[model samples]
Target chain A: MSASIYLDHAATAPLAPGVAEVMHDVLVGAPGNPLSQHAEGRAACAHIDAAAEKVAGLIGAEPREIVWTSGATESSNLALRGVAEFIGAGARIVSVVTEHPATRDTLSALAKQGVTVDWLEVDAHGAIDHDALAAAVAQGPDLVSIMQVNNETGVIHDVPAIAEQCAAAGVALHVDAAQSLGRLPIDVSATPIALMSLSAHKIGGPKGIGALYVRRRAPKIGVAAQIIGGGQQRGLRAGTLPTHQIAGFGAAAAQAARHGIASQPEWARLRERLWQGMAPLGGLLRNGRPETAAAPFLSVSVTGVHGAALITGLNEGEPALAVSTGAACSAAKGESSHVVRAMGRSPREAAATIRFSLGPGVDEVAIDAAAQRFRDEVRRLRTLAEAA
Target chain B: MNRGAADDAIRARFLRPTYAVDADAVDAWPASGAADTPGEDARCRVFLAVGNDGRLKAAFAAFGPPVVIACADWICERVTAQTVEITHTVTLADVEKALALTPTQRYAGLLAIDALSNAVINLGQ
Candidate 1:
């Protein structure tokens, strides 16, 4: 990492070391269509298959279960739309208000088309009410969609327990695991989840590749294909696969598998150190419960400070602390966070909230510096507010 | 079109806020007006203590994005020492041009106009 602190890993991580090398190799060495019958085409197909297996291994899934798409957005779109199309309209889907835009908006669109979308309410700490979810599932919805980890607050959802509920209710569970895939371990075989969405860029891979895991075993999910050009990936998604992107994603996933889980303790310590450094700023309120939130994340909202100014201050100062006001997409739109608002925060508190997501190479020194920068900026803005 | 501290003028004004309302001194202002622009989640309140000669001494308080606060600060600088009539003529376009605000930041300009217009109206009362 450079001297500037990059604490927005959930938005996107810097590419892992070997990722560039692998992508370059694929781009230069084997530039052939994977669908062709030639030797070069066979080699390209092997490259894609290897990438599929690596991604599958990361989630403890079968290689055949993975369907490649552009990114998490596409994966989520396919997972939600495909199921809705297959089950037909009038089928009910249960979800939460805190889902990423890809899932939330897709669910909304489905709702517009006569699919009943039951939005589950979250508590003040951003946790979904499990009893509510179970009750929704008991109503025999066709699918239950929720994220494995919240992108804004880093609140980790209890997906395994929810998956068990869905299984008992005979309802399909679709998890958007874009934020949790590499940072946390997910064993598909262990959990009774029916589908999942995974992203490459969020885990240090290339931006354009992602996967949707469709369970092919005993309760086979017969999803209709959203894209229909060339019948690639068993007619689920159709297009010429980009070998370079897939190879980069595979390289990133392999490295994350090696280090992501193992580095959690260090990340947790850094997160705590960051809180300690900023705790003296008396108005700081941690957004999520530390016990339940992911270790790489430290989300807080400062009272008596404008959120936009705080973000701008951090982003513009010396050694700019690259954090987020919320998800990158929502921030770009200049809209308040739906996730924060859903958790019952006032618009001001939601606007003032900052999400700091840590990753590899963000050490103790960086954490301390970032925390101090946050403290100084909040104090400066508070002074400005008071003076105003 | 939010200008950060990288813009030296915005940085200086935002950090110094030379004409910001000191909370303790707010009660002493003879006339005050406030406007809330709900669309942008911005609020701007302008307090004035007019001189005996009718020259205005303007102070402002605002809450919202940095751009809004910076715009309020810039407005305070521009409107101070001017006649009440001139303060009313401080258009939204003028604030936009003076601050180099972007298309998305036009709301801040509107907010500045509302607060200054309200303050000028209060001077009559």
Candidate 2:
């Protein structure tokens, strides 16, 4: 079997080295439910608590303020539903069109439950309209939710600016940091964000574990519980904590802190290398501004080529180039990416976009291979197109 | 997306699609047909070039998912060099069977048939 160069880090990054060992240690060493009052249970609870601290440390939040959930999707649902339920009906919620489906679908459900919904517009470059957002904020909306980094486009919103606006407006802010959690430095205490959603899988940790940072000090926030059972997590979330997964997540978090946004420059250089390598092939259009986007992700749409065809072709080749046509959810749905559509791209462009998200251990040779593979596929498909 | 549902043949055709189209041979035929369809969230255009002797040269342009593209390539390969009247005898089931399309990919077969039927209609034979 030929080795593949994976470029779908936005979907789910591979587990970091040593993370599996940490998880295995916990799985074998601590096998009791965290809820039990026995010594074994206490040992399990200690693992859970240490994991919580690690996750909190990554975002500069108090461990007491973090609530664990199944992953970013559940964290999103819990954050949105919990807050919406707390604020009650007739409250207004504002969010951008480029949010992940977790937040987008939850907001749609909130709309159905009698909360008014207003969508913030994004420009062609995928930047949120600051003036429009300020005006919306002035309308006295109860909550504002925006993603820190767009999953498909890698566009980074001005979270601190948005947080300040929401704070001045007396509106609670929820930042979906799934894409930005490990890639960016997020001090929840300094950002004025009331709630933030984070995922472990996106940061070289295990899947099926995530956390929500609820501001507990200044601008203290409370959320109604979405899942109920043993009244764990102070009633915010309830279940027997997965110590193994939490341990992996904690180890991942600790590892992430050692670098803490220092690798961004290298990531940007590698992204540029791929882009430049393919630019000479022509018909390349970037989906988001590189200056504002996350360093590791480069989303480009090609003219005169089918996006899905390119994706499949790249993956099927020798030394396969594994990338994404869009976000993981929409890619499976076999639909044009909504993030590209929201950026004012034509339906054809939306269908032709490919997201190249890099990760650790991806060297220049792999980037060149990916670029060459992309060029070959585009040429092949375009020749077929012209003939047709 | 889990593409494991598709057989290796279909998967290979979708990936490399060696039978997609030939640039020099497309415009030289005397009779031709074409069809357009809205696929999933994209569009597909299938074209055929027919010789005076009634044989076909098939080519397709698609912006849809892998299933639709592969289906076009599969049908084009099957129909090329066959008599122009073959479109009348061809069934959606034939194309689906040839591609080993999964249930989710069944619509791609319909699309292929639609395009092939339209190409035959455009032949005006």
Best by TM-score: 2
Taking the candidates one at a time, how many backbone clashes does each contain? Answer: 0, 0
Q: Could you say which candidate leads in DockQ?
A: 2
Candidate 1 clashes between residue pairs 3 or more apart in a chain or in different chains = none
- Predicted candidate 2 versus true structure: per-residue lDDT over A1-388, tens digit per residue: 1348898888888898899999999999999999899999999999989988999999989899888888999998988888888878677889999899998899998888898889988999999889999999999987898999999999999999999988987888999999999898899868899999999998899999998888886665558999998999888999888989989999999888886488888999999999999999888889898899999999998877766667777777666877878743223244678899888876677778889999887899999988888888888777755644
Model 1 whole-model lDDT (C-alpha atoms): 0.85
True contacts kept of 1: 0.36
lDDT by residue (A53-109, candidate 1, tens digit) is 899999999999999999999999998899999999577899999999999999999
DockQ of each: 0.34, 0.43
Give the Cα error of residue A9 in candidate 1, in Å.
0.2
- Residue ranges of candidate 1 with Cα displaced over 4 Å: A1-3, A327-335, B1-35, B45-59, B79-89, B100-107, B113-125
| Candidate 2: CAPRI quality band | acceptable
CA displacement after TM-score superposition, residue A93 of candidate 2 (Å):
1.5
Model 2 lDDT, residue A170, Cα? 85
In model 2, where do residues sit more than 4 Å from their true spots? Answer: A1-3, A327-334, B1-6, B25-31, B39-64, B79-88, B102-125
